[model samples]
Target: MPVTGADVRRIALALPGVVERASYGTPGWRVSDKLFARLHEQDGVLVRLGAIDEPELREVLTDAWRARAPKRLVAELAEPDG
Candidate 1:
């Protein structure tokens, strides 16, 4: 089943110290007043995954550049019943 905003809220609220608040006119989740997640008006939800080391970030970017979805998985998702 597809997830909804309420599902997101339920999960986020269960986390320790998480609080729901309005951020930039949208729903947001914060811990200790630090914004950790937010729902965008045009885009979908975003989560702050935290800072990564420079070297690790470089490697991650490089891997992303080479990544490709498997044809089978892509076809599955493209099906009407997916």
Candidate 2:
């Protein structure tokens, strides 16, 4: 089964010091008042992974988009200059 918002909330809140709060009218997870994850209006869930190098970040993001995003969006994102 696909993961749901409830599942994300449960997992996020299980972490020490993590809290559930509103971000731009949507559910977000934070630690020490710093946002870590949010349910985006158009993109579903967004998670902040800090301080990654560009190449590695691109690879990780591309893999994630390929797995979850619509094929059209993934293709657009996968373009050489995108």
Candidate 3:
């Protein structure tokens, strides 16, 4: 099945300090208010991830979150989940 905005939202929100906001009138995901992913036309989303799986998408979102989040926040993410 094709990925949906809800799927993206679910994975992105799991990351440290990620939130959903509006971007160009569509749903966008951000870390510390820094945009990492936005949902737009099918083409736009596909351009970012060409046929990606859930695990891969999670990795991608985590990497994006790590890049945009504050140093301290990223460090917090490094700690193992209890």
Best by TM-score: 3
Q: Rate the local accuracy (lDDT) of all candidates.
A: 0.52, 0.57, 0.79
Indicate whether candidate 1 or candidate 2 has the larger lDDT: 2
Write model 3 residue lDDT over 1-82, tens digit each, in one string.
Answer: 5556678888888888888999999988888889987777755443354477777788888887888999988888888970
Compared with the true structure, what per-residue lDDT tens digits does model 1 show for residues 27-55? 87766566655667463323222334434
Provide TM-scores for the models: 0.51, 0.52, 0.82
Residues 1-82, model 2: lDDT tens digits: 3455665666666444557899999987666566766676473324333334444544543453345445565555556764
Backbone clash pairs for candidate 3 read none
Candidate 3 overall lDDT versus native? 0.79
RMSDs, each prediction?
15.3, 14.2, 2.3
Say which prediction, candidate 2 or candidate 3, comes out ahead on TM-score: 3
What are the runs in model 1 whose C-alpha is more than 4 Å off?
44-82
Model 1 scores worst on lDDT over the 10 consecutive residues at 60-69
The candidate, 1 or 3, that scores higher on lDDT is: 3
Best by lDDT: 3
